[model samples]
Target chain A: MVSFTAGDAVARRPAKPGRLSRFFFAGNGAGYMFLAPWLIGFLGLTLGPALASLYLSFTDYDLLQSPRFVGMDNYVRMATGDAKFAAAMKVTFIYVILSVPLKLIFALALAMAFNRGIKGLPFYRAVFYLPSLLGGSVAIAVLWRQLFAADGLVNSVLSVFGIDGPSWISNPNYSLYTLVVLSVWQFGSPMIIFLAGLRQIPQDMYEAANMDGASKARQFFRITLPLLTPVIFFNFVIQTIDAFKAFTPSFIISAGTGGPINSTLFYTLYLYQEAFGFFRMGYASALAWVLVLIIAVFTAFSFLTARYWVHYDE
Target chain B: MNDAAHAAPPGDTPERPILHSVLIHSALIGVSFLMLYPLLWMVSGSVRPADDMFGGQTSLIPSQVTLQAYKTGWFGLQVSFGTFFLNSLAISVLATIGNVMAASVTAFAFSRLEFFGKSFWFALMLGTLMLPYHVTLIPQYVLFLKMDWVNTWLPLVVPKYFAVDAFFIFLMVQFFRGLPRELDEAAMMDGCSAWRIYWKIVLPLSLPVLATAAIFSFIWTWEDFFGPLIYLGDIHSYTVQIGLRSLIDSSGTSDWGALFAMSVLSLIPIFLIFLFFQRLLIEGIATTGMKR
Candidate 1:
């Protein structure tokens, strides 16, 4: 890529870029000038809040009262006593495991179909991606609620074959699955990413496999799967992180409560309830730290395991 | 669009045996139906009378299409939906502009300038991508509350001005890094300052990514519920997302058709944006994912 350099013809500036020169006239000053916004954000909005949240995790600071130091009480409660936290964790892990894999499978399948060289390829891509574009909106979440009601479109569709459908948002067992379906439905981003990955695989590899008398399935496993691993890993890490952060649908569909016996209580929703609803800022900060830890552990695990499976030809 | 992307590779004939072609098309068409069905139902629901919205009626077109829902939902509960739309548009447009501008300058610095601790800063920037927003929510809220910026759009919009959305900045950095180094050198030889090189050379060439940033920031801000939800209290300050939420949560006398109508109306702007910039968004997302 891109790099700016003084041309060789203008070769008089070989002097050292010391403190005074760096501050006054060197590229560093200009560079930092350009980075002012992000720099300020890093120090103030991001780094400050992040560190504060860590400190806040040990205190009982509701908005009304000044934070009183509680010394690991929040952690103790979370680890040892909070049944709701456990339930929320269970619900979220299940949602993430179920949704991420299914969404990726759908994305990969369609991307393969698109790569088969369909006409109006962009149009199809846009149509499929439409859900994802609107996926996080309250309108879509509300629409989801209506679509899965006992009297709603899903049951209506099911009734054609003379079968009944449950009130997906009402039943505790099924409410979480409805959110999972919503997650799966918004597979368009991963689909496009998969398409890009599919494009990067050299056609010659498939041709070479075919020459070796490899069947399509064999070629897929040997050539496609291995080559696609890096992209798969990227999607997995990004989507898993995203799945863990899912809020709008859970909040909107469940009407801001982790209702129907707390089945749809995503971790973020529970965190929200703790912080905003109950104004338990300390407890919520602890929950937030746990989330960061969970994401970091999973990301680290993915990178570790990636060496075994994710092949990068470069 | 890249020519290489569209230009099919040699011997990659898409037209194949009849059975295979039929099967593939059937699968694609079938799945496409699944993909489109929810929106179709939503649109249909929007047009139907309240009584006809649910309960075993799967028809995409009702027997008698009605505008009653539109008429009612447009006014909403007390405040008309138009005010919410304007509020959403104001927030979204301002945020998009801030994001695009902030990301450009920031990306320019990271990509071109030899700065101290650049790698550390870059890593820190990327680290924020996975730092759950919940960590930032309370302190920032507290900070804003102290500033008396709560009950205002500042809490939602101010961070964009600070390049707080690392995703867009990262995306732009990737795009900028992909550009040819020679162009910058040649421009620099003509005595173009780094700012000029950035403003004239880099900015012009980086339209695709900038546009991508604009579109995504717009869509996300428009759809954002949490920030506005947390910061703004009461309906008068509500963005469309919060407005829609209130409409949904309004007690027992819920009007399904009106709700559907309002929902459809809410989706229209995003739909139009997606239709126009569908290619850019797709490519942006792809590049962000695969290139990284």
Candidate 2:
């Protein structure tokens, strides 16, 4: 089916310029050809859905019939009437507020420890990072459920001290805290980033501080904290977005119910329930836009104030 | 003063401080136990008798060991767990190949070629990395449902061919920028075309990032639960994650040992991949964070 010219290989010699070359390949038409895959995906999957959701937010479709026009009704209902929406938002905020700081603190602490020239850095990094790599998995979520069962490990350990620990995953008062622990436990990702940042700091600065009679605490406050703030801010933004997107763990642990008095009802989980479980696709679309607005505001607020605290030495 | 200066490197802690190592190492080991104990207990729980699993006794090992849980859990409800594993492997491998090829070619264009709206396209690609999936989930699901692709791997695997993962494209773009342009010029001087230079030069030199993209794609696809959960409705077509979740939901605690057994098995492929490619995985993550 295919034919090759005999002199074509010889025509690729280094000594000559062909007349039609520049005219044929003048622009980056081939480049666009290469980029066609992503270009199509952007138009079809991302932009199309984004616009569809915006339009869907204004209607009342439930995947069964045509979406009835109900402009601002969904927003008004969510803002004033939906108790579950309020609860899910509250739980999500609590998760982001508590888990972000705790996870960052642990990450920074471990990164500093690893910077102390400990041998077997790879071993520790591997072990610490394993949880994060596996944290989003169903197996880990199921394990969390089993680990905090009424007669599970935590209660058994508490009983050893003659203390009674409530059923962690089942109790409303304790379930959210258990999820927070799960978030905190996977501190490996931020820890690794912090470690990379720690490695970037000049050692001579600390040595100079040491010679000037600055204590270890002073050196940390003066050198490490100020310099590491950029990485911290970066991690903060990423982890906050991630915490808002938390779903699999709570979904698996709560058996897709978001129950136990709605303690562990995350925003995405609630959005999912609206779209599929209850077939409230239009409501879920509104909820999705609200989530986008929430995330964009947080990200913009961080960027606006970043110059004050997130110092970049260079 | 001279002795102190010459004692050790500046990054090292104070000399003759054995207590420092002791404190740091002990804390790491203790917290490491807290981090790892649940997974270890799951492995142990999968082997013990079903009655012993939920009991008050919390031994790390059982008084007796048995494989009956594995036997029953493998058979599962109707189809076996092996079927799930095979399904995951087939999907992950194909998706990985698709993503790596698409991402690398896209990155090649972004890094090496100049066209209209190039910067805008690059920014848009980076923007997709942060846009939450929920924004796009509904319409994509609707599209797939319309196409009757709901219960198949098409909904899951097809997007990778279209370069749906912006992160990989970003990664490969960074890698491609690091490559020198002299090789391209030399190839052009020898009358080679752009495609020839891409196939012969850039790709050969950028193997590391390509491998990095493939590894991450495979691992993520293998562990992905939400996508498969939303798309696949047939039990016979279940991936391992959906299978595990169904087990938990269906029987509750009627078969704790079997559920634990299946859970432990589900983690094996990721565990092995993580073990062998730890360095590459860490490098990929570290570079993604620090460079940006």
Candidate 3:
């Protein structure tokens, strides 16, 4: 009902004598004026840095000296010689794959439970969402480390049942899993999103299915899951992206080493270590680009495959 | 919206059995406890005496509650935790102000004013939303290092003033677009400049979204570890996040009680924000589908 394009604004203006007058009278000046800050940021911070990083990726640049142009050397090294690079990729993929779906599933389940007209919905929602709000904090990561320690709360809980739990944070095999659990623990945001999506499903659809004697579980599969696929896709993409960029937990948990045999070596952590820890700025830039490529490919691949699964209300 | 419609309708009649209701409530309660367990444990651990801090104790209630850990943790490091809190508070406040102001200004342009290449810039902004920060991390660091902005709060705070966070801009734009055009048209007919309209009409009417942006900006800035860790080398300039990390690194689990106490102290601000602003935070996430 309200269309306010540049053309519409121009049409609302009085007839002008010349191009110069039209340019002066138009909204362009005011628009650009308002956009100045964002524009400066986009150029100077985002786009400029992106391109510079791309260029820097080709060279061998430590922070202490000028970059040497060694085209494709970094890529070749990553592909052929670097075991840690491979390990980091393996660890990151495992993290992203395991954490994203697990988190989303937990989110969706809790969201569904919350949507069932519970008595204290807001309180429950707030309580659940608190962890997510705090999940990215250094405190939570610190808490996570302590929780998974050998004599930590998790093992303490296990010991009560006459079972000894492994030292999760220090053990390479279990350390990544601890991070994954930490991730799944903060499923509140996606749960909120899923709850919002669930509310949008028409009640009539369920009503119609019920009249046909469809079971509740059947109704969920036939009606709810299909209709909720778009939200699922959205959450999938977003959670996957966020999981890929996850740093604080691993950084804090690993004590910034990504060690205990580099088992918890997240890609971002690896990139951070290379750039800052080792001063391998050029190699870090290369790692950064590789990460961007991985994400882009994954996103594009998801979108390409989305038509097979994601349903829209056409 | 009747109560029946709001209830679980597809599975049964409007009135459910007492057993089902009890089951659901208990399930929810159990899960909620499980969810809050770690946080609660940390709080308990913080108050516990140093000797009782560890050794397979998962009790929510401490054997003996003491403020000694708080005292020790507050002054444990070279720079007091209080200084880190002040540093974090300063950065978060400045960053929040810059983010909300710049984002609202930019959103006004995108939503209300029309300019050449508007679509192009809008698309670019959206693209940045998905672009990995890693891609820009090295170069931005180099850029800041070159400009001698690394050690100061400039690297952490100034980009916010320039509206580098495209997510906030996008969020505000979505909020601004929903605002009725009639008000803008009326103001324009009254010969009000675009700035006057934005500052007077739109911003005043956009308090909820403005508040959302401000709250999120502050929380995110406060919670941010990477930025401060990378840029702020001086311990005195460290944010709460960096300070917490430094606690672990310096003490190396020798003072778990102090560590737990400092951790609890660090979370207090966020917990307070959540307590006071739960509605705004929830609605903001639900409406925009933005991650916290």
Write candidate 1's Cα lDDT for B83-179 as tens digits.
8999999999999999999989999999987777789999999988778788888999899999999999998999999999899989999999999
- Candidate 3 lDDT for residue B185: 95
Which has the higher TM-score value, candidate number 1 or candidate number 2?
2
Model 3: CA > 4 A from native: A1-25, B1-16
Please compute DockQ, using alpha carbons, for every candidate against the native two-chain complex.
Answer: 0.61, 0.52, 0.81
What would the C-alpha RMSD of candidate 3 be, to one decimal place? Answer: 5.2
| Pairs that collide, model 2 | none
What digit string (tens of lDDT, one per residue) describes model 2 on residues A142-236? 88887787877889878888888888888999999989999999999899999998988999999888878798899999999999999999999
Model 1, residue B44: distance off in Å is 1.2
User: lDDT at B137 for candidate 1?
Assistant: 86
Candidate 2, superposed: residue stretches over 4 Å from native: A1-25, B1-16, B290-292
Compute the lDDT for candidate 1.
Answer: 0.87
| Cα lDDT tens digits for candidate 1, A1-314 | 12334554234454544445754556777878999999999899999999999999999999888999999999999999999999999999999999999999999988988885776687778878888888988888888888888777888889999988888889998999999999999998899999999999888887787667788789778888888989999999999999999999999888888888989999999999999999999999999999999999999999999899889786
Model 1 Cα shift for residue B271 (angstroms): 0.6
Compose the digit string of candidate 2's lDDT tens values, residues B1-292. Answer: 5447545655666654556677888999888887888888889989997767764667798878999899978886777888898999999998999999899889988998777778999999989988998999988988999999999999889999989989999999999999999988888799887788889999999988998888899988988998999998998889999999888877785787888899999999889989888888898888887211
Q: Could you tell me the TM-score of candidate 1?
A: 0.93
Q: Rate the local accuracy (lDDT) of all candidates.
A: 0.87, 0.87, 0.90
Scanning candidate 1 chain A in windows of ten residues, the lowest lDDT window is A1-10
For every candidate, C-alpha RMSD to the true structure in Å: 6.0, 5.8, 5.2
Ranking by TM-score: 3, 2, 1
